[model samples]
Target: MTTQELLDQIRHKRSFLCVGLDVDLRKIPGHLLEEEDPIFAFNKAIIDATHHVAVAYKPNIAFYEAYGIKGWEALRKTIDYLNKNHPDIFTIADAKRGDIGNTSAMYARAFFEDLGFDSVTVAPYMGKDSVEPFLEFEDKHTILLALTSNQGAFDFQTKDSEGRELYKRVLETSREWKNSKNLMYVAGATKAEYLTDIRKIIPDSFLLVPGVGAQGGSLEDVCKYGMTKDIGLLVNSARGIIYASNGKDFASAAREEAEKLQAGMNAIMRQNI
Candidate 1:
Protein backbone atom coordinates (compact mmCIF):
# COMPACT_ATOMS: atom_id res chain seq x y z
CA MET A 1 0.00 0.00 0.00
CA THR A 2 1.05 3.61 -0.57
CA THR A 3 1.83 5.77 2.46
CA GLN A 4 -1.36 7.79 1.94
CA GLU A 5 -3.44 4.63 1.90
CA LEU A 6 -1.84 3.55 5.16
CA LEU A 7 -2.65 6.95 6.69
CA ASP A 8 -6.25 6.58 5.52
CA GLN A 9 -6.51 3.18 7.20
CA ILE A 10 -5.23 4.65 10.46
CA ARG A 11 -7.76 7.49 10.28
CA HIS A 12 -10.65 5.22 9.37
CA LYS A 13 -9.88 2.72 12.13
CA ARG A 14 -8.73 5.35 14.60
CA SER A 15 -5.76 3.04 15.05
CA PHE A 16 -2.22 2.43 13.87
CA LEU A 17 -1.96 -1.00 15.49
CA CYS A 18 0.17 -3.63 13.75
CA VAL A 19 -0.55 -7.05 15.20
CA GLY A 20 2.56 -9.25 15.03
CA LEU A 21 1.66 -12.78 13.95
CA ASP A 22 4.72 -14.33 15.53
CA VAL A 23 3.26 -17.71 16.38
CA ASP A 24 4.84 -20.48 18.40
CA LEU A 25 3.17 -23.85 17.99
CA ARG A 26 3.67 -24.79 21.60
CA LYS A 27 2.06 -21.62 22.79
CA ILE A 28 -1.01 -21.79 20.58
CA PRO A 29 -4.21 -23.51 21.61
CA GLY A 30 -3.78 -27.28 21.65
CA HIS A 31 -6.95 -27.79 19.64
CA LEU A 32 -5.54 -25.87 16.66
CA LEU A 33 -2.89 -28.53 16.13
CA GLU A 34 -5.63 -30.84 14.85
CA GLU A 35 -5.86 -28.63 11.77
CA GLU A 36 -3.71 -29.54 8.77
CA ASP A 37 -1.84 -26.27 9.04
CA PRO A 38 -1.85 -25.16 12.65
CA ILE A 39 0.28 -22.11 12.09
CA PHE A 40 -1.97 -20.70 9.41
CA ALA A 41 -4.97 -21.72 11.46
CA PHE A 42 -3.68 -19.70 14.40
CA ASN A 43 -2.78 -16.71 12.26
CA LYS A 44 -6.12 -16.73 10.42
CA ALA A 45 -8.02 -16.83 13.67
CA ILE A 46 -6.01 -13.96 15.10
CA ILE A 47 -6.35 -11.88 11.93
CA ASP A 48 -10.06 -12.56 11.70
CA ALA A 49 -10.55 -11.60 15.31
CA THR A 50 -8.45 -8.43 15.22
CA HIS A 51 -8.54 -7.13 11.66
CA HIS A 52 -11.10 -4.44 12.41
CA VAL A 53 -8.89 -2.89 15.04
CA ALA A 54 -5.50 -3.52 13.44
CA VAL A 55 -4.24 -1.57 10.44
CA ALA A 56 -1.31 -3.91 9.74
CA TYR A 57 0.02 -7.44 10.37
CA LYS A 58 3.64 -8.56 10.59
CA PRO A 59 4.59 -12.25 10.39
CA ASN A 60 8.00 -12.81 11.87
CA ILE A 61 9.93 -15.08 9.51
CA ALA A 62 12.04 -16.94 12.02
CA PHE A 63 9.10 -18.58 13.75
CA TYR A 64 7.93 -20.02 10.45
CA GLU A 65 11.40 -20.81 9.12
CA ALA A 66 11.99 -23.06 12.11
CA TYR A 67 9.35 -25.48 10.82
CA GLY A 68 11.06 -25.77 7.43
CA ILE A 69 8.88 -26.25 4.31
CA LYS A 70 5.77 -26.73 6.40
CA GLY A 71 6.47 -23.42 8.09
CA TRP A 72 7.08 -21.62 4.81
CA GLU A 73 3.90 -23.03 3.27
CA ALA A 74 1.94 -21.85 6.31
CA LEU A 75 3.41 -18.38 6.00
CA ARG A 76 2.40 -18.21 2.36
CA LYS A 77 -1.12 -19.34 3.16
CA THR A 78 -1.33 -16.74 5.90
CA ILE A 79 -0.25 -13.97 3.55
CA ASP A 80 -2.53 -15.20 0.81
CA TYR A 81 -5.44 -15.23 3.22
CA LEU A 82 -4.70 -11.67 4.28
CA ASN A 83 -4.41 -10.48 0.69
CA LYS A 84 -7.65 -12.13 -0.33
CA ASN A 85 -9.71 -11.23 2.71
CA HIS A 86 -8.29 -7.93 3.91
CA PRO A 87 -6.37 -6.35 1.10
CA ASP A 88 -6.53 -2.96 2.78
CA ILE A 89 -4.55 -4.15 5.76
CA PHE A 90 -0.81 -3.69 5.30
CA THR A 91 1.32 -6.88 5.49
CA ILE A 92 4.96 -7.00 6.58
CA ALA A 93 7.36 -9.89 6.40
CA ASP A 94 9.38 -9.50 9.58
CA ALA A 95 12.28 -11.02 7.65
CA LYS A 96 15.28 -8.90 8.60
CA ARG A 97 17.06 -9.59 5.33
CA GLY A 98 19.83 -7.66 3.59
CA ASP A 99 22.92 -8.83 1.79
CA ILE A 100 25.14 -8.20 -1.24
CA GLY A 101 23.44 -6.32 -4.12
CA ASN A 102 22.51 -9.39 -6.19
CA THR A 103 21.48 -11.39 -3.14
CA SER A 104 19.40 -8.48 -1.93
CA ALA A 105 17.64 -8.37 -5.30
CA MET A 106 16.65 -12.02 -4.94
CA TYR A 107 15.51 -11.42 -1.37
CA ALA A 108 13.46 -8.46 -2.55
CA ARG A 109 11.74 -10.54 -5.21
CA ALA A 110 11.00 -13.33 -2.75
CA PHE A 111 9.18 -11.06 -0.29
CA PHE A 112 7.86 -8.33 -2.58
CA GLU A 113 7.09 -10.37 -5.69
CA ASP A 114 6.70 -14.02 -4.72
CA LEU A 115 5.29 -13.66 -1.20
CA GLY A 116 3.39 -10.43 -1.86
CA PHE A 117 4.22 -8.64 1.36
CA ASP A 118 3.61 -4.89 1.36
CA SER A 119 6.92 -4.48 3.15
CA VAL A 120 9.88 -6.38 4.58
CA THR A 121 12.18 -5.57 7.47
CA VAL A 122 15.77 -5.21 6.20
CA ALA A 123 19.07 -5.03 8.03
CA PRO A 124 21.26 -2.19 6.76
CA TYR A 125 24.63 -3.49 7.98
CA MET A 126 25.73 -4.08 4.39
CA GLY A 127 25.00 -0.43 3.56
CA LYS A 128 23.20 1.16 0.59
CA ASP A 129 23.79 -1.56 -1.98
CA SER A 130 22.09 -4.11 0.25
CA VAL A 131 19.05 -1.86 0.74
CA GLU A 132 18.57 -0.05 -2.57
CA PRO A 133 17.34 -3.18 -4.36
CA PHE A 134 14.40 -3.43 -1.97
CA LEU A 135 13.63 0.29 -2.41
CA GLU A 136 13.41 -0.07 -6.18
CA PHE A 137 10.02 -1.73 -5.90
CA GLU A 138 7.15 0.71 -6.36
CA ASP A 139 4.62 0.84 -3.52
CA LYS A 140 6.55 -1.77 -1.52
CA HIS A 141 8.42 -0.64 1.62
CA THR A 142 11.84 -1.56 2.97
CA ILE A 143 11.72 -1.11 6.76
CA LEU A 144 15.36 -0.79 7.78
CA LEU A 145 16.25 -1.76 11.31
CA ALA A 146 17.41 1.34 13.14
CA LEU A 147 17.53 1.72 16.92
CA THR A 148 16.13 -1.59 18.10
CA SER A 149 14.64 -2.27 21.51
CA ASN A 150 16.91 -5.14 22.49
CA GLN A 151 19.53 -4.81 25.22
CA GLY A 152 22.23 -5.76 22.73
CA ALA A 153 21.30 -2.62 20.80
CA PHE A 154 23.76 -0.76 23.02
CA ASP A 155 26.51 -2.87 21.48
CA PHE A 156 26.56 -0.86 18.26
CA GLN A 157 23.51 1.29 17.53
CA THR A 158 24.32 3.82 20.25
CA LYS A 159 28.12 3.70 19.95
CA ASP A 160 29.91 6.89 18.86
CA SER A 161 31.01 6.92 15.26
CA GLU A 162 32.78 10.08 14.05
CA GLY A 163 30.71 12.24 16.44
CA ARG A 164 27.35 10.56 15.62
CA GLU A 165 25.74 7.45 17.05
CA LEU A 166 25.80 4.65 14.48
CA TYR A 167 22.00 4.45 14.25
CA LYS A 168 21.76 8.15 13.43
CA ARG A 169 24.29 7.66 10.68
CA VAL A 170 22.22 4.78 9.29
CA LEU A 171 19.16 7.06 9.15
CA GLU A 172 21.09 9.92 7.54
CA THR A 173 22.95 7.87 4.95
CA SER A 174 19.88 5.82 3.90
CA ARG A 175 17.91 8.87 2.77
CA GLU A 176 20.20 9.41 -0.20
CA TRP A 177 19.63 5.94 -1.72
CA LYS A 178 17.49 5.25 -4.76
CA ASN A 179 13.71 5.59 -4.14
CA SER A 180 14.38 6.49 -0.55
CA LYS A 181 10.73 7.45 -0.09
CA ASN A 182 9.96 3.73 -0.16
CA LEU A 183 11.90 3.43 3.08
CA MET A 184 10.38 3.10 6.54
CA TYR A 185 12.19 2.11 9.73
CA VAL A 186 12.10 -0.19 12.72
CA ALA A 187 12.46 1.65 16.04
CA GLY A 188 11.99 -0.26 19.25
CA ALA A 189 9.31 0.94 21.64
CA THR A 190 11.57 0.07 24.56
CA LYS A 191 13.79 2.92 23.38
CA ALA A 192 10.96 5.43 23.59
CA GLU A 193 13.07 8.27 24.94
CA TYR A 194 15.55 7.86 22.11
CA LEU A 195 12.79 8.68 19.63
CA THR A 196 13.22 12.40 20.32
CA ASP A 197 16.60 12.33 18.60
CA ILE A 198 15.32 9.76 16.06
CA ARG A 199 12.46 12.04 15.05
CA LYS A 200 14.79 14.95 14.49
CA ILE A 201 16.60 12.89 11.86
CA ILE A 202 13.65 11.48 9.91
CA PRO A 203 10.77 13.45 11.34
CA ASP A 204 8.15 12.13 8.96
CA SER A 205 9.03 8.55 8.03
CA PHE A 206 6.69 5.85 9.32
CA LEU A 207 8.21 3.72 12.05
CA LEU A 208 7.21 0.07 12.61
CA VAL A 209 7.55 -0.06 16.36
CA PRO A 210 7.74 -3.45 18.08
CA GLY A 211 8.05 -3.81 21.86
CA VAL A 212 4.82 -2.61 23.36
CA GLY A 213 2.71 -4.92 25.57
CA ALA A 214 4.88 -8.01 26.22
CA GLN A 215 8.11 -6.05 25.78
CA GLY A 216 7.01 -3.35 28.25
CA GLY A 217 7.36 -0.35 25.96
CA SER A 218 5.18 2.63 26.70
CA LEU A 219 2.76 3.60 23.93
CA GLU A 220 2.39 7.08 25.37
CA ASP A 221 6.12 7.84 25.41
CA VAL A 222 6.57 6.53 21.86
CA CYS A 223 3.82 8.75 20.52
CA LYS A 224 4.80 11.80 22.52
CA TYR A 225 8.24 11.67 20.90
CA GLY A 226 7.72 9.82 17.60
CA MET A 227 4.32 10.78 16.27
CA THR A 228 3.79 13.19 13.38
CA LYS A 229 0.59 14.96 12.28
CA ASP A 230 -0.12 12.04 9.97
CA ILE A 231 0.09 9.45 12.78
CA GLY A 232 3.36 7.93 11.58
CA LEU A 233 3.63 4.79 13.70
CA LEU A 234 2.63 1.14 13.46
CA VAL A 235 2.91 -0.07 17.04
CA ASN A 236 3.10 -3.87 17.23
CA SER A 237 2.25 -6.39 19.94
CA ALA A 238 2.86 -10.10 19.42
CA ARG A 239 2.89 -12.30 22.52
CA GLY A 240 0.77 -9.93 24.58
CA ILE A 241 -2.17 -10.09 22.23
CA ILE A 242 -1.96 -13.38 20.30
CA TYR A 243 -0.97 -15.43 23.34
CA ALA A 244 -3.41 -13.74 25.69
CA SER A 245 -4.88 -17.23 26.10
CA ASN A 246 -4.17 -20.75 24.88
CA GLY A 247 -7.74 -21.85 25.39
CA LYS A 248 -10.51 -22.37 22.88
CA ASP A 249 -11.37 -18.71 23.32
CA PHE A 250 -7.91 -17.73 22.08
CA ALA A 251 -9.22 -15.75 19.14
CA SER A 252 -11.66 -13.81 21.25
CA ALA A 253 -8.99 -13.21 23.86
CA ALA A 254 -6.64 -11.96 21.16
CA ARG A 255 -9.38 -9.63 19.92
CA GLU A 256 -9.86 -8.21 23.39
CA GLU A 257 -6.15 -7.54 23.79
CA ALA A 258 -5.89 -5.90 20.37
CA GLU A 259 -8.94 -3.75 21.15
CA LYS A 260 -7.24 -2.55 24.30
CA LEU A 261 -4.16 -1.46 22.34
CA GLN A 262 -6.33 0.09 19.61
CA ALA A 263 -8.16 2.05 22.26
CA GLY A 264 -4.85 3.33 23.57
CA MET A 265 -3.90 4.40 20.05
CA ASN A 266 -7.29 6.02 19.48
CA ALA A 267 -6.91 8.03 22.65
CA ILE A 268 -3.46 9.19 21.60
CA MET A 269 -4.82 10.31 18.25
CA ARG A 270 -7.60 12.25 19.99
CA GLN A 271 -5.11 14.19 22.08
CA ASN A 272 -2.67 14.91 19.26
CA ILE A 273 -4.91 15.23 16.20
Candidate 2:
Protein backbone atom coordinates (compact mmCIF):
# COMPACT_ATOMS: atom_id res chain seq x y z
CA MET A 1 0.00 0.00 0.00
CA THR A 2 1.08 3.58 -0.68
CA THR A 3 1.57 6.15 2.07
CA GLN A 4 -1.56 7.97 1.01
CA GLU A 5 -3.59 4.77 1.20
CA LEU A 6 -2.23 4.00 4.67
CA LEU A 7 -2.97 7.53 5.86
CA ASP A 8 -6.48 7.27 4.49
CA GLN A 9 -7.08 4.01 6.33
CA ILE A 10 -5.93 5.47 9.62
CA ARG A 11 -8.18 8.48 9.07
CA HIS A 12 -11.19 6.38 8.10
CA LYS A 13 -10.77 3.84 10.86
CA ARG A 14 -9.95 6.46 13.49
CA SER A 15 -7.08 4.11 14.37
CA PHE A 16 -3.40 3.41 13.84
CA LEU A 17 -3.41 0.07 15.64
CA CYS A 18 -1.36 -2.71 14.03
CA VAL A 19 -2.30 -6.14 15.36
CA GLY A 20 0.59 -8.60 15.41
CA LEU A 21 -0.65 -12.13 14.65
CA ASP A 22 2.14 -13.96 16.46
CA VAL A 23 -0.20 -16.89 16.88
CA ASP A 24 1.29 -19.93 18.60
CA LEU A 25 -0.54 -23.17 17.98
CA ARG A 26 0.37 -24.68 21.31
CA LYS A 27 -1.29 -21.80 23.16
CA ILE A 28 -4.45 -21.55 21.06
CA PRO A 29 -7.72 -23.08 22.21
CA GLY A 30 -7.33 -26.87 22.25
CA HIS A 31 -10.54 -27.07 20.23
CA LEU A 32 -8.82 -25.21 17.36
CA LEU A 33 -6.09 -27.86 17.24
CA GLU A 34 -8.77 -30.12 15.80
CA GLU A 35 -9.06 -27.76 12.80
CA GLU A 36 -7.10 -28.71 9.74
CA ASP A 37 -4.80 -25.71 10.20
CA PRO A 38 -4.87 -24.43 13.75
CA ILE A 39 -2.69 -21.34 13.31
CA PHE A 40 -4.75 -20.00 10.46
CA ALA A 41 -7.91 -20.92 12.31
CA PHE A 42 -6.87 -18.72 15.24
CA ASN A 43 -5.82 -15.91 12.90
CA LYS A 44 -9.08 -16.07 10.94
CA ALA A 45 -11.14 -15.76 14.07
CA ILE A 46 -9.07 -12.84 15.36
CA ILE A 47 -9.26 -11.08 12.03
CA ASP A 48 -13.00 -11.61 11.82
CA ALA A 49 -13.52 -10.26 15.30
CA THR A 50 -11.15 -7.28 15.14
CA HIS A 51 -10.57 -6.28 11.50
CA HIS A 52 -12.50 -3.03 11.82
CA VAL A 53 -10.55 -2.01 14.90
CA ALA A 54 -7.10 -2.12 13.34
CA VAL A 55 -5.47 -0.58 10.29
CA ALA A 56 -2.81 -3.26 9.86
CA TYR A 57 -1.92 -6.91 10.58
CA LYS A 58 1.66 -8.09 11.07
CA PRO A 59 2.63 -11.75 11.17
CA ASN A 60 6.04 -12.38 12.69
CA ILE A 61 7.76 -14.92 10.47
CA ALA A 62 9.51 -16.80 13.31
CA PHE A 63 6.25 -18.00 14.82
CA TYR A 64 5.48 -19.85 11.60
CA GLU A 65 9.04 -20.71 10.56
CA ALA A 66 9.58 -22.62 13.78
CA TYR A 67 6.81 -25.04 12.82
CA GLY A 68 8.54 -25.68 9.46
CA ILE A 69 6.68 -26.33 6.17
CA LYS A 70 3.18 -26.60 7.60
CA GLY A 71 3.65 -23.29 9.40
CA TRP A 72 4.81 -21.60 6.21
CA GLU A 73 1.82 -22.93 4.29
CA ALA A 74 -0.47 -21.61 6.96
CA LEU A 75 1.21 -18.19 6.74
CA ARG A 76 0.71 -18.08 2.98
CA LYS A 77 -2.93 -19.07 3.23
CA THR A 78 -3.58 -16.55 6.00
CA ILE A 79 -2.04 -13.69 3.99
CA ASP A 80 -3.91 -14.70 0.85
CA TYR A 81 -7.18 -14.76 2.75
CA LEU A 82 -6.57 -11.23 4.05
CA ASN A 83 -5.62 -9.89 0.61
CA LYS A 84 -8.79 -11.23 -0.95
CA ASN A 85 -11.10 -10.44 1.98
CA HIS A 86 -9.80 -7.11 3.31
CA PRO A 87 -7.34 -5.59 0.88
CA ASP A 88 -7.53 -2.25 2.63
CA ILE A 89 -5.92 -3.58 5.78
CA PHE A 90 -2.16 -3.12 5.52
CA THR A 91 -0.28 -6.42 5.78
CA ILE A 92 3.30 -6.72 7.04
CA ALA A 93 5.61 -9.70 6.91
CA ASP A 94 7.52 -9.02 10.09
CA ALA A 95 10.47 -10.98 8.77
CA LYS A 96 13.16 -8.38 9.53
CA ARG A 97 15.26 -9.51 6.57
CA GLY A 98 18.26 -7.86 4.96
CA ASP A 99 21.20 -9.32 3.06
CA ILE A 100 23.54 -8.64 0.15
CA GLY A 101 21.86 -6.80 -2.75
CA ASN A 102 21.03 -9.83 -4.88
CA THR A 103 19.60 -11.78 -1.96
CA SER A 104 17.69 -8.78 -0.63
CA ALA A 105 16.04 -8.29 -4.01
CA MET A 106 14.84 -11.91 -3.94
CA TYR A 107 13.56 -11.51 -0.39
CA ALA A 108 11.68 -8.40 -1.53
CA ARG A 109 9.96 -10.37 -4.29
CA ALA A 110 9.10 -13.22 -1.92
CA PHE A 111 7.17 -10.93 0.41
CA PHE A 112 5.85 -8.20 -1.90
CA GLU A 113 5.09 -10.32 -4.95
CA ASP A 114 4.69 -13.91 -3.80
CA LEU A 115 3.06 -13.36 -0.39
CA GLY A 116 1.38 -10.05 -1.31
CA PHE A 117 2.38 -8.30 1.89
CA ASP A 118 2.02 -4.54 1.75
CA SER A 119 5.29 -4.13 3.65
CA VAL A 120 8.19 -6.06 5.21
CA THR A 121 10.33 -5.16 8.18
CA VAL A 122 14.08 -5.14 7.39
CA ALA A 123 17.19 -5.07 9.53
CA PRO A 124 19.52 -2.19 8.57
CA TYR A 125 22.77 -3.22 10.24
CA MET A 126 24.27 -4.13 6.84
CA GLY A 127 23.72 -0.55 5.59
CA LYS A 128 22.18 0.93 2.40
CA ASP A 129 22.95 -1.67 -0.28
CA SER A 130 21.34 -4.38 1.84
CA VAL A 131 18.18 -2.26 2.09
CA GLU A 132 17.98 -0.46 -1.31
CA PRO A 133 17.04 -3.67 -3.11
CA PHE A 134 13.83 -3.98 -1.09
CA LEU A 135 13.01 -0.28 -1.57
CA GLU A 136 13.06 -0.72 -5.38
CA PHE A 137 9.50 -2.01 -5.41
CA GLU A 138 7.04 0.82 -5.94
CA ASP A 139 4.33 1.46 -3.31
CA LYS A 140 5.53 -1.48 -1.22
CA HIS A 141 7.32 -0.40 1.98
CA THR A 142 10.62 -1.45 3.60
CA ILE A 143 10.37 -0.78 7.31
CA LEU A 144 13.94 -0.58 8.60
CA LEU A 145 14.72 -1.45 12.20
CA ALA A 146 15.82 1.65 14.03
CA LEU A 147 15.40 1.72 17.82
CA THR A 148 14.08 -1.67 18.86
CA SER A 149 12.12 -2.48 22.00
CA ASN A 150 14.51 -5.15 23.25
CA GLN A 151 16.66 -4.48 26.29
CA GLY A 152 19.86 -5.29 24.40
CA ALA A 153 19.13 -2.45 21.97
CA PHE A 154 20.85 -0.10 24.41
CA ASP A 155 24.15 -1.89 23.77
CA PHE A 156 24.62 -0.16 20.38
CA GLN A 157 21.60 1.87 19.36
CA THR A 158 21.93 4.56 21.99
CA LYS A 159 25.69 4.43 22.45
CA ASP A 160 27.52 7.59 21.43
CA SER A 161 29.79 7.19 18.45
CA GLU A 162 31.51 10.23 16.96
CA GLY A 163 29.02 12.21 19.08
CA ARG A 164 25.98 10.68 17.32
CA GLU A 165 23.66 8.00 18.64
CA LEU A 166 23.74 5.01 16.30
CA TYR A 167 20.01 5.12 15.55
CA LYS A 168 20.17 8.86 14.88
CA ARG A 169 22.90 8.21 12.35
CA VAL A 170 20.83 5.43 10.84
CA LEU A 171 17.82 7.71 10.25
CA GLU A 172 20.10 10.41 8.84
CA THR A 173 22.00 8.11 6.49
CA SER A 174 19.09 6.01 5.20
CA ARG A 175 17.53 9.09 3.59
CA GLU A 176 20.18 9.14 0.89
CA TRP A 177 19.52 5.58 -0.29
CA LYS A 178 17.54 4.67 -3.42
CA ASN A 179 13.75 5.00 -3.02
CA SER A 180 14.12 6.22 0.54
CA LYS A 181 10.83 8.05 0.13
CA ASN A 182 9.16 4.67 0.49
CA LEU A 183 10.93 4.10 3.80
CA MET A 184 9.19 3.71 7.14
CA TYR A 185 11.01 2.84 10.36
CA VAL A 186 10.59 0.37 13.19
CA ALA A 187 10.83 2.49 16.30
CA GLY A 188 9.95 0.51 19.40
CA ALA A 189 7.32 2.06 21.67
CA THR A 190 9.59 1.42 24.64
CA LYS A 191 11.98 3.97 23.17
CA ALA A 192 9.40 6.71 23.56
CA GLU A 193 11.90 9.23 24.89
CA TYR A 194 14.02 8.93 21.76
CA LEU A 195 11.11 9.75 19.46
CA THR A 196 11.79 13.45 19.84
CA ASP A 197 15.29 13.00 18.44
CA ILE A 198 14.07 10.50 15.86
CA ARG A 199 11.45 12.98 14.67
CA LYS A 200 14.05 15.70 14.23
CA ILE A 201 15.83 13.49 11.71
CA ILE A 202 12.78 12.20 9.83
CA PRO A 203 9.84 14.30 10.83
CA ASP A 204 7.38 12.98 8.27
CA SER A 205 8.35 9.34 7.92
CA PHE A 206 5.99 6.71 9.34
CA LEU A 207 7.19 4.63 12.30
CA LEU A 208 6.10 1.01 12.96
CA VAL A 209 6.21 0.88 16.74
CA PRO A 210 6.07 -2.39 18.67
CA GLY A 211 6.53 -3.03 22.44
CA VAL A 212 3.25 -1.71 23.71
CA GLY A 213 0.90 -3.57 26.11
CA ALA A 214 2.62 -6.80 27.15
CA GLN A 215 6.01 -5.08 26.98
CA GLY A 216 4.71 -2.33 29.25
CA GLY A 217 5.42 0.61 26.98
CA SER A 218 3.10 3.54 27.49
CA LEU A 219 0.84 4.29 24.47
CA GLU A 220 0.34 7.85 25.64
CA ASP A 221 4.11 8.47 25.78
CA VAL A 222 4.59 7.12 22.25
CA CYS A 223 1.93 9.40 20.81
CA LYS A 224 3.27 12.35 22.70
CA TYR A 225 6.75 12.03 21.19
CA GLY A 226 6.32 10.02 18.00
CA MET A 227 3.09 11.32 16.39
CA THR A 228 3.42 13.61 13.39
CA LYS A 229 1.10 15.70 11.23
CA ASP A 230 0.21 12.53 9.34
CA ILE A 231 -0.23 10.56 12.57
CA GLY A 232 2.97 8.72 11.62
CA LEU A 233 2.74 5.74 13.94
CA LEU A 234 1.60 2.13 13.77
CA VAL A 235 1.58 0.92 17.36
CA ASN A 236 1.55 -2.88 17.64
CA SER A 237 0.34 -5.20 20.36
CA ALA A 238 1.05 -8.92 20.01
CA ARG A 239 0.84 -11.28 23.00
CA GLY A 240 -1.33 -8.78 24.83
CA ILE A 241 -4.09 -9.08 22.27
CA ILE A 242 -3.79 -12.41 20.48
CA TYR A 243 -3.00 -14.35 23.67
CA ALA A 244 -5.55 -12.54 25.78
CA SER A 245 -7.51 -15.75 26.04
CA ASN A 246 -6.51 -19.35 25.31
CA GLY A 247 -10.11 -20.59 25.15
CA LYS A 248 -12.70 -20.81 22.36
CA ASP A 249 -13.65 -17.22 23.14
CA PHE A 250 -10.11 -16.04 22.40
CA ALA A 251 -11.19 -14.11 19.31
CA SER A 252 -13.78 -12.17 21.23
CA ALA A 253 -11.23 -11.33 23.90
CA ALA A 254 -8.76 -10.20 21.22
CA ARG A 255 -11.42 -7.93 19.78
CA GLU A 256 -12.06 -6.39 23.17
CA GLU A 257 -8.33 -5.66 23.63
CA ALA A 258 -8.07 -4.21 20.13
CA GLU A 259 -11.14 -2.04 20.70
CA LYS A 260 -9.53 -0.51 23.77
CA LEU A 261 -6.44 0.49 21.78
CA GLN A 262 -8.54 1.70 18.85
CA ALA A 263 -10.57 3.90 21.16
CA GLY A 264 -7.37 5.42 22.54
CA MET A 265 -6.08 6.06 19.01
CA ASN A 266 -9.38 7.72 18.07
CA ALA A 267 -9.10 10.11 20.96
CA ILE A 268 -5.46 10.93 20.14
CA MET A 269 -6.32 11.65 16.51
CA ARG A 270 -9.17 13.89 17.56
CA GLN A 271 -6.97 15.81 19.94
CA ASN A 272 -4.24 16.17 17.34
CA ILE A 273 -6.73 17.60 14.86
Question: What is candidate 1's lDDT per residue for 1-273, written digit by digit as tens?
Answer: 999999999999999999999989989999999999999999999999999999999999999999999999999999999999999999999999999999999999999999999999999899999999999999999999999989999999999846899999999999999999999999999999999999999999999999998889999999999999998899999999999999999999999999999999999999999
What is the overall TM-score of model 1 with all chains considered together?
0.99
What's the lDDT for candidate 2? 0.94
lDDT of 2 by residue, 68-173 (tens): 9999999998999999999999999999999999999999999999999999999989999999999999999999999999998999988985699898889999
Cα displacement (Å) at residue 188, model 1? 0.4
- Each candidate's clash count: 0, 0
What are the RMSD figures for all models against the true structure? 0.7, 0.8
Q: Report lDDT per candidate.
A: 0.96, 0.94
Query: Residue 238's C-alpha lDDT in candidate 1?
Result: 95
Candidate 1: segments with Cα more than 4 A from true spot: none
